[model samples]
Target: MSAAHRPGLRVNAALIIPESELSWRFSRSSGPGGQGVNTADSRVELVWDVANSAILPTLQRERLFERLGGRLVDGVLTIAASEHRAQLRNRDAARERLATLVADALRPPAPPRRATKVSRGAKERRLTAKKQRTDVKRLRRPPTD
Candidate 1:
């Protein structure tokens, strides 16, 4: 089925953004369509208002704002696709891009790394290797009377 007919864009197992939340804007594409490039509106821009979406829970909404701050303008995220000559293909591309981007941003932050100290055995091995290297260099020097 075409992306236009889908009920919503599924960002993850828990988050599905309804079609009503997505808006599209199109314009003439800049490349590869030969004679049709100038007239065909193959470039697609998909915009979603992250701040106003009804589907998002409060925590998820705040996470989206925090993770996607650089990309969001007035709490809206926009995805653009122009690589395809067909409008429908461009639409699909834009949809996929939007889904991937939102999914990534919605992901939970990774747990903090725990600090670790070097093991005694590892420190001993390192010191042994250094001492071996020093002995080898001493052996290389010419013997004095």
Candidate 2:
């Protein structure tokens, strides 16, 4: 759906951040706009208040806090987009980026890894390879009696 008619930004099946919670800032982009670059505000910054959002579940909020700690400042998350020359495209890019980031943060953590030891056969093969390499190097040396 278009931004104008859309109710909120869909992060995942369980989460939809309302438009009211999103804020936008725009400035002239630094690259590739030719003459329009000077006059247009093509760079977009999309900010969301994750800590204060009404739509976030308790667990999701905690997960976001933990996963995005470096990115967030004072409980707010900001995403910037400037690759596009048009303001609308930059805005869309920012929104998509925010949604993806929030969805990843809300995902469950991976299961712990299980450690294992090398098999006896594998150890024997490795030893055999080392012996072969040593014999080859010894053969390359000149005979000394």
TM-score, candidate 1, is: 0.91
For model 2, residues 1-145, the per-residue Cα lDDT tens digits are: 5777889999999788899999999998997879999999999999999889998878888999999999999999999999999889888999999989988888899999999999999999999999999999999999999
As a whole number from 0 to 100, the lDDT of residue 8 in candidate 2 is 93
Q: What is the lDDT of residue 20 in candidate 2?
A: 90
In terms of lDDT, the poorest run of 10 residues in model 2 is: 1-10
**lDDT by residue for model 1 (12-119), tens:** 898889999999999998968799998899999999999999988999999999999999999999999999899999898998899999899888899999999999
TM-score of each prediction:
0.91, 0.90
Quality of model 2 by C-alpha lDDT: 0.92
Candidate 1 weakest ten by summed lDDT: 2-11
